[model samples]
Target chain A: MMKRIGTYLLQSKYAISVTVLIFVVLGASLATSSFLTGDNLITVLRQTSVLFILSSGLTAVVLTGGIDLSINNSAALVGCIVAQLLLLGVSIPVVILAGILVGVVIGIFNGLLVGILKLPPFVATYGTNMVVLGISTIVMQGKVIYDLPRNFTPIGVGYVGILPIPVIIAIVLTGVLYFVLQKTTLGRNIYMLGSNAYAAKYSASRSVLDTVVAYVICGVTAAIGGIVLTARLNAADANMGNSYGLQIVAAVVMGGTSLLGGEGGIFGTVIGALVLTIIMNVINVIGVSSYLQSMAVGIVIILMVWLDIFTRSKREKLSRV
Target chain B: MTTKSLGKRIGSLPPAVWMIAVMLVFYGANTKNYFTASNFISILIQAAPLFVVACGQTIIVLMQGTDLSLGASLNMMTVVWVVLMQKSLPLSVALPLAMGTSVLAGYLNGLIVAKMKLPPFIATLGMQNILNSVALVASNGSSVYHEHAIYKIIAKSSFLGVPYILWITIGCFFLTMVLLKFTRFGARVISMGGNPESLKVAGYSPDLATIQAFTYTGFMTAVAGFLLACRVESGNPIVGNGFEFNSVAAVLLGGTSMREGRGGVGGTVFGVLLIQILKNGLVMMNVSSIYQTAIIGIVVLFAIMLDAYIKRRQEE
Candidate 1:
């Protein structure tokens, strides 16, 4: 019975993530001793909250076989906007509303390019990333604004009865996204579009035009991630989210979403995010050099993709035999 | 019948016409000095290295593959060349050595993608990381400075009121154009890109074609690195960052299909100019460098979308 349960667990994609997470927790708990304490655990959750939110949005876009490389830049720009407006004494709610709106606008722009114009996703986002970076730089004049109000800070750091507000928000967002991805008509359309757009159009009455909305959601989520990041840092810098674009894509893909699209889920992505966070924390704990860390991340990425490919082809060979 | 053929030819111009027209308008509006001999020459000189790099990138993209490692490869060449020159080797020797390393890098990228059957994106991205690390290590993470006379002549010194780099860029363009248009190898490349499986069935090897494309990209990256080294009169390990994007942007903007099979060095020429001019114009107009990045990004998006629209209309 134990062996059968083990086989079932090991056969799942979530297994790899679970194993990695366990290794991290065990390592952290052993080394720091303070690591498994409630406060430290809460700190890890809070740190991971922003990445989770961003990855959720990116998950939707990748589902449609598209990527949003401009998210980091978009986040930077939105964060700068949020900071500038708050400095102008704009209310917290209004700042939040404006931030979400800016993300949607960027999303709409991405949608127009990919959906209507049919430009390749990689190229379209590459261009928008530069634009967003430039805009953010202009807004902040290459400075970080640090004078945010107390209410703003709580969205990232505040807790209610041992659970952080950001974590709570992340949980709610995940549930909502899970529903949208699994149960909604729009969600199914996205899967159809990513898997086979032509077939979807002919069979499911899916419009390529409307499928663009998914990318917008991806953009907005990235913006929200930016807001959370700004709150955590208590400032908005021009290049703040720069490292995220590649990392989030790595996390999503590692979580089992195909770069070719139409596979994977948020549950896997959450684990992926947690695993990534743990790997990063482990790297820090182990005191790996920053330069070497890039090489390590690159290696891990290649290995994950290689394993997926090998397993896929092995299965294909087995079926053929 | 002749008019119909002419109409078709006009329709096929795609994004190049708009890029050129926009460049001219932007230049004219932004500066009274736009058409002056000095300014024209300056723009060409500034665009020289990018144009040479994009020439290589154009060939690879024509084969329906991309070389994201171009910038990283260029950085490697720059560092190597700088170090070799520093070791008292003549500029001539160091330059050839740098070019050779680029070819090797390109060859490896081609091998991984063609032989190992790795996706071009993953292969090139891996090559980018490896080369980026090698470049940092080669220079020990510092810029290498030298003052060789020949190097100065090649990178910075001008002849007849034009930079030597401009001449090199033009020379490379003409060579690529001739090779692509007149050589059997070039014909084979276009055919392979058009349909690799069909080409294979017809007794051509797609692997060989892919390798050739990558090798060409490597060689051009070296040429670009040489120009950059001379222009700055030094080689900084990190100097080549964003070069791949610039090259890709130019190639795509110039009407080269990302899917390969349909691109030319000629269109890439105009595309390179358009990118360089847009950047220079932004600087000239006193737009902050930060905002300029955003503006360029937006313009590139517009350029690609415009290209897509033109292609769609042509199909209809």
Candidate 2:
């Protein structure tokens, strides 16, 4: 029975993430009554919505065996552009479209560098990150754009019946992405390409286009995250997305997406995002010093990746036996 | 025929050398103060610590790994040094302790990458966070100023009309050159980058090479941190911010292949100089800091793209 259970655990995609989430939730609940409360849970979900969107996009890139460090900066730049446009009395829809377009352009640029030019993804995205940061700074001049339009706030804070709009948006995007990843031939191509690009080449999978599309999707999602973030804060700043880059990476990796690529799903990412949010919430509830939060995050990331490597190797050994 | 061959030789020189020559000609024509020896010395001084740090990054990159946490590690070392000095510890004691902390930080990063088989980028990213937090905790989020007579003397004093910092930087370059060219360890590092599996097949542990490379990186970053602290006379939490990217840019700009062992310290020196010169030239040209960063970004992109094109052509 125990062996059967072990096999079941290994077979299910969501099993490990679900198990981890349950433990985290239970731990949080036991630590403080505030954690289990409906209000706090909603708050956690609301806060996680932006990260969820960002990580969803990052997962696609990781699955393609590439990374988009520029996502956070792209989001920040988009937010800044949207905020500036709104301040200039542009229509909200136009501003949103412009932000997303900017993201797509940046994404295309990254795709060209990584896909066609064959530049290393890390360095290429890092260069794009710097360029975006510079543009964001030039646009805002290091100042915060606050007092956004009242209509824009709905996207961030408005409720849809019992659920927050951001949470709803996150859910819808996750569902769409999950479908695209699971049901489409393109999705299969992406996995195959990431798993072994050399083999994928001979298979004629249009791997280059697949890589480009992955980054484009990543960029669009990050832009959406930026818009939500700007609305939520009622302000935009060039530095707003600086921390999100590493955070998204953490979430995507913790979700069981291999950095080596081609082995994770959106369901795992959602649980990973939740785990991170809950850890943050627990830290807040316990009144841990804010200075230690980054340290905690770093430790969690290392532990998660280490656990991943350990488990995969163990499985390999067991299979060999 | 001789002239054609000479032209070809010049053409074969690393892009950084050409960049330097062009910038020199352009800036020499455009800015009146650009050609002055004093201005040149100032540029060297500014580039000194960055050169040291980039040397460390180059070594790690040569091993097909990266150390994104170097900037944070540098900051932590600086903070520790200053905090210890603030507690009335002598320079001799505080300096070694701070340096030791850097070695430990590097060792931890090496351990994660070598033992756990985590990608260097992710491992170093996590290490960066941890080190940044440690720096914050050590400094309590404030800059610490120290103006000891000995500290100032070491940083500011000159020998043979060159700044002490410049001398230290030169010493570091010589040391790195020797380590890379004269040591078996260095050969192993390059070989590991060229092919990790082959090293294992050859009965050498790539893991040891990885650890040693990171340890060297950690040591140099600590030295750079010390030099920076001495120069600024303060240990600010944000002092080392953005350095990781800058150092990586310099290393790559120097012609080091991001993939593995295709470049070395010779190109890296020129890369560091090119960045410093660019910054100095921008300042002289009155370009806004924001535009300066953007231009640097563009330059890095252009350099890598050009390198890629050249390499592809060669392969063809």
lDDT of 2 by residue, B4-123 (tens): 999888766767888889889988888877888889888888888889999999999888878889889988998999999999899899999999998898988888999999889889
Which pairs of residues collide in candidate 1?
Answer: A131-B294
The lDDT per prediction is 0.78, 0.86
Provide the RMSD of all predictions against the true structure, rounded to 1 decimal.
3.6, 1.9
Which candidate has the highest lDDT of all?
2
lDDT tens digits, residue span B173-196, model 1:
998888788986788778767877
**Candidate 1 Cα misplacement greater than 4 A, ranges:** A1-11, A16-44, A197-205, B1-7, B75-105, B115-118, B122-151, B158-162, B182-185
Error of 2 at A158 (Å): 1.4
The TM-score values for the models, in the order shown, are 0.88, 0.96
lDDT of 1 by residue, A224-256 (tens): 888888888889899898657556766776777
TM-score of 2: 0.96
Candidate 2 regions exceeding 4 Å error are A1-7, A197-205, B1-8
Model 2: pairs clashing at backbone N, Cα or C within 3 Å = none
